[model samples]
Target: MRKIPVKYGIEILVICLTPFLFMISESISNGKVTGILFSFGYLILVGFVIFGIRYWIENEELVIQNLLFWKTRIRISEVSKIEKTWNALSSPAPSITGRVEIYYNKKSIVISPKNFEEFKNELLRINPNIIIKE
Candidate 1:
């Protein structure tokens, strides 16, 4: 079994946090009850800020887990194509760069495993038929 942590993008983080912080600050300054709700919402965001994404391999399955109660499992044998991509779309991937689109079981998902080569090698070791495009 192997576990790989996800990478993070500082720029993307800043882009996401800026407005949230601004709204919280503005609401608090206005002395509104909504400020308290905003504060709670901010805490929720902070709780998920790290994402805690882990791409772990166990037996023949690849499990993707995050801080939230979110988990995705894909069979190694089901993996069809692995292609490198840099997308801003919200996904399990916390990082914008070093993201890869994994096609599996007639479906797809994007993720960012810190060590791409190692992850790819391990995937191939389990299922040599998996196609990878650089």
Candidate 2:
């Protein structure tokens, strides 16, 4: 099992909430009902950040847990291919770091591991049939 690095969680939270902070500050300057709404929004944003951080810290098996919705894991023999590709729109924005693709049969999953090269090599060691692409 592998855990997401704490720095990645903090970076993501900061990037997402920085714009809202600016908006909230502007609303306060305007001195209107908008300020109250912005304040509430800020609280909600903070809540999300907290949840994300907790999730990152609690989760293990980086790819398996992070891409569970996609059912990434299967018996090693079932894997047909593994390749790496980049797409700003479909992939996670701002590219958290150490991103890779895990392919099994007809399905594919995206995950960001803490030590990408080591993770890939480990996977290959586990299942030599699995392919790795640059």
The sequence of per-residue lDDT tens digits that candidate 2 reaches over residues 1-134 is 43444224456567667777777777778876777697777878565434433112212222343222432235545555666555333333224554566677677655555556766665666677777787
Error of 2 at 35 (Å): 4.3
Off by over 4 Å in 2: 2-15, 32-63, 66-77, 90-97
- Deviation in angstroms for 19 in model 1? 2.1
Error of 1 at 43 (Å): 3.8
- RMSD in Å for candidate 2, one decimal? 5.2
**Candidate 2 displacement at residue 23 in angstroms:** 2.0
Model 2 alpha-carbon miss at residue 58, Å: 14
* Steric collisions counted per model: 0, 1
Q: Whose TM-score is greatest here?
A: 1
> Each candidate's TM vs. the true structure?
0.85, 0.58
Per-model C-alpha lDDT, please? 0.83, 0.53
